[model samples]
Target chain A: MSGVAVRAGLFEQTDAGVTLLGDRCRTCDAHQFPRAGICTLCGAPDPVPVQLAATGTLWAWTWVTAPPPGYDGPVPYGFGVVELPEGLRVITRLVLDPDVAPTVGQPMRAVLDTVGTDPESGHDLVSWAFSPLDASVGL
Target chain B: MTTSEVVVAGVGIHPFGRFGDRTATDLGVVAARAALAEAGVTAREQIGITFCGTAYGGVASGHRVMSALARSGGPIVDVEAGCASGAAALMLAASAIRSGQHETVLVLGLEKMPAGVIRSSFFAPWQEQAGLTPAPAYFALRAQRLMATAQLTTRDLATVVVKNRANGVANPDAMFRTAVTVDEVLASRLICPPLHLFMLCSPNAGAAAVVLRRARPDDAGAGSVRLRAAALRSHLPGDVLGEATPLSGLAVDDIPAASTLAATAAYEEAGLGPDDLDLVECQDTDAARELLAYEELGLCGPGECGRLLRDGTTAPNGALPVNVSGGLLSKGEPLGASALGQVVELVRQLRGEAGARQVDGARVALAHTVGRGANASVTILTR
Candidate 1:
């Protein structure tokens, strides 16, 4: 079944795969995910939009057993921090098999996956997540 | 800032636990009145101003508390910085006294939180929907990194819970006063990888208050605790990986954590270093956080926190005890009251009044707290 992106302007579905949308400071070259109007580092106004890297290394990972308020996601979901080559670390969900445990420094590729269901709309909510590059199967 | 001395004339608390039907104002009034009585301030008009810290407390929280105490008509400001709310209020109150704006000020911290996991508005709606707002995931992720880099083990984490829970047994105001074994802590339900239910602190109700006044030359031998330093700092731009950062950053390791910045500023302001401290009360929202704080506060070198616990260096009877009031792990965190509760504990220890949990010869003590919005605060007290 297909799903809708949880939030618009955060990622794009291109022919190549899911690519994150971010903003890079024109003055200091600092990159930020989820986009920003101004550079957080140099305070340069009007940072330009850029496509973040599609693959990165897992910096950290955890299995969240309890769901947060207003979150209609499945319990025991995997969460992680992925460090991209552009020096930006993105907090994303991990698409992993039930038996597979994630390790740091593992290669990860961005993918759009269902994170939860919208309580009001009853529609599956999709968000950008990281999957192990070596995995032959997808969640 | 002027060189005027600001002293803590009195401190009070409303105990840390769930209080059914008791409003935040009720807790705040009880604590405030106790502090005022201890300070011998019968004339309500003598209070120059009031600063109240709260995160969950609604609009005009301080005004409601002041009105209940019949201490209205004075300037009452409410401050909020997540868990560092109380420290932020205390910092402003001390500054007012030092700047000669107010000769005497009352600082109060109170909270009445809902049950279960802490819910914060720090994250955007999308992030919350993505299952990122409960906060334990962030702490567990941090712990994962610490284990890989700092050689911290799950055993070490359990040991921290054991130590703090044992210490809580001696504290009457603490919520959880029973001690648990390391094995028991590890066997508890795993909320997240590397963290168990016992390793985390509960969000509950409580309040703490302090009376700060300009010190006089004649007050030398009256056993007053002087506020040597109250430094609050925010996260640097690239400190997304730090303790309080809710979202992404430049992910650079060069930027110092908020705790480090606050601790450095406080050490400089107080003209003291880690060696001069006799006791410490630091943020222990989770077991791993306390270990990280030891490094951030310069209490030990990097990669040495696990050793600090294994060697019993931070035990209650050890030199330079930490969290003798059982810490948030035992006392339960009320956000607003957490930092000031630490201050109240320090005052008791400095005055040789911390019953069974007293640290012998605690002349210089420090209280540190860091929380959401990437804010950190460090307060140093000397008798």
Candidate 2:
């Protein structure tokens, strides 16, 4: 199945896999997600677009039962901070079942999946999330 | 004068709860009028400036409030700094008085939030789309981390709720006056993992107002309370792993949070330390966040909050007696009025007017708040 990203410039999906897009400052060696025009760490005026590691480790996780406004996803979903090998962390929905309890320091690999569907257009709203590398945890 | 002494001449509040028919303007007017009357200034013309803090009240909120009171003669400013809006506004009013820019200033905080979960727009659109926008999600995440590091359990979190609710029973102005047991808190529906429904505050409606003036000669002998320090701080770069952060967070550790920075500045400016505080009213948006605040405000050592809770070090009769007003947990957070509501409680404690919840011989008190924008404010008041 094919679907578009929920937001632009966050990540790209291709035949190979999904790679998170980010900005790295050449002058200061700063890293940020969502491609910043300037380096947030060093105030450098120039930043180069860089692809982040697709796999990371789950540092912390939570089950969000109460949804926010405009949320069109299943209730009681799991979301957490995934720490990439590069050291920066990105908050993403953990591709896990609501009843599944995630442990800290678990290996996680980013996967492009459907977060919700636009009711009018009937198009799946896809975003990147981290799934347990272990098949048992993924279930 | 580089350090002019500022005093809180008066304070007022419209009870925090669902006032379905009343608008933010009405609440603000009522509180402002009571504050003005308490200051012995019957005429609003005596107020040289006014600052109104609100998150939802739209443009010219201060102007609308001033016009309602027929006090539109002076400069009126509307300030928004997330949940610290009221404290920020009070800080501004105190600064104007300290700088000799105005003799008398009125600070008002008003809010009328929508029912149910508070949907904040502070996160990026993508983050929101990923279902990370509900306020409690971040709180639960933080709580989970704290539980790991501080060796706290769900029972400890529930105990915090029970303590605060018990304190709330004595506060006439608090929204939830009924107390809850630990079992009840634990049984409450889970909004976010590690955070039960009763453990978190509701986004409700209310308003708080205070009148500030330069300390006069007679203030020395009177019962008036002086504002020793009103300090505000914003989030620093690389400190993004906590509440209200967007998609990305820094890898670095040991970066001080906004609350610590604000508290340090406030303590320095007030010539006091955590040990000197007679009582406190830190933001208890959730049960665990209050534990984090104990460390951030220098009330206890890091990772020592669990012990503090077990020993009742922050209970009404404990060493610190934090949030004796029942806090946002009991008051149902009206973002704008939240911080100033803390001040009103501090005033009551200091003046010995807090009938049942009063801490014995309270002289120095601190009110702390933190919210979106990573804004943190700590206001120290002394009698």
Candidate 3:
């Protein structure tokens, strides 16, 4: 597990709730994540910002005990495919109860998965993780 | 109907598995050499373009492979559409050849998943500290949402494993050649809630290639298959919203819409309907996606996919005869190569090269592949 030190994106510190983010093509009205310069839909290029919805339904997902390379983290993580209300489906690490197994169409809300920051680069990579909307974690 | 003719002259595949012996470059070179050799083309002089496919190998990976092979120094580009990388390369190669850019082009798919826990954008330093890292959680969230919205059951997904495993049993080249029973699949260790280990495709390593050009009677041999269409529809950013109407303002992020969008594009581009297809190679890295694929590819009525699977509609000899080559579930996911490898199998089957697992008289075939990025590629092939 990566140790915690301050000085990251700090986006997770805010309680704005995880809203799936994307760019809506100013020219063609298309939305996507990671913000692409090329408008993949109509090839118009230059997609402006259009914040996606916070709530979405779960599609299908798989548990990746083994992550991809360069990912230094815990084992047995829950990676989910979320169908945002925006029509964009996303894959993210989820914040769900361990006993809870979400089906095809369960309601979920987004939460910022705060990956600890690198004391070096300072580009705190934050994850937008989804939580089962029905149940709240007991703090 | 578009009459642009492009056929798969040859396809080469290296077995998918961890090879401590060689690097990804070696794997790619082997597949490329195999493809060139199979086409019986002595020189790369005839090839005008190359689209080398890889996701996690190295920077300028394609250039390195081509330069190492000493093949076509012609314009070469690398494609990284996540899981659809190979098919994306295939699409680029096909377009180049059909547009008269090159007489023959090679599409190579290769990957060497470095030994480690694969951390992606899903979980990085921030996600890990927040208790997020595994990819299955991302997919699980999707499954959870689907079950609630679609009114489906976990057993509905078991059919995917059942069908694919049965299909895989006959494939010697399959990574997991053993056929699995529903009970066995159901009993396997759970990766995500309701999703079993048997339902998941492992991270594998391998390389696959296909060389495309104008149809040559002597080359695809008397029986080789022709590439009718290679369609790639990248998801439009995050939501891939479900658009019900221009005015309703209700966007549903249903899997079928995305899949239908891609599959429809491919079928239309090829001028063939679902009925004209003899087989389907939909992505089933996990089981739930397989059911979604059934609807996305128009193989059955929505909500009736579970019924279709129960009734054997998607079995090897069933109405659509889907995934006869053992989907990613049984085949193991060397993500980069798996997509084009789907094409390789279809090309082999259409050309009477699939051997025992060959669908009796399959003249038309379709291959669809997807990744965590939700990128999709569907290619239609005919003999």
The models' CA-based lDDT, in order, is 0.88, 0.87, 0.70
Against the native complex, each candidate's DockQ, computed on alpha carbons, is: 0.74, 0.70, 0.24
For model 3, state the Cα shift of residue A18 in Å.
11
**What local lDDT score does residue B170 receive in model 1, on the 0 to 100 scale?**
93
Model 2 lDDT tens row, A24-120: 8899787888688898878888799899988888888888876788687777777788888877888787888556677999989878767788555
Q: What are the models' TM-scores?
A: 0.97, 0.97, 0.78
Highest DockQ against the true fold, candidate: 1
- C-alpha RMSD over true interface residues, model 1: 1.4
Task: Identify the runs in model 2 with alpha carbons over 4 angstroms from their true place.
Answer: A119-121, A136-139, B1-3, B124-126
Task: Give the least accurate 10-residue stretch of model 3 chain A, judged by summed lDDT.
Answer: A5-14
Badly placed stretches (over 4 Å) of model 3 are: A1-137, B1-3, B115-117, B121-133, B148-152, B216-224, B237-256
Clashing pairs in 2: none
Ranking by lDDT: 1, 2, 3
Rank order (by DockQ, best first): 1, 2, 3
Model 2 TM-score on a 0 to 1 scale: 0.97
Candidate 3 C-alpha lDDT tens digits along A1-139: 1223332332232255645546777786756664557665567777886567778886655566554444544455556566676656665666666676656579877775444455566655455667778878411
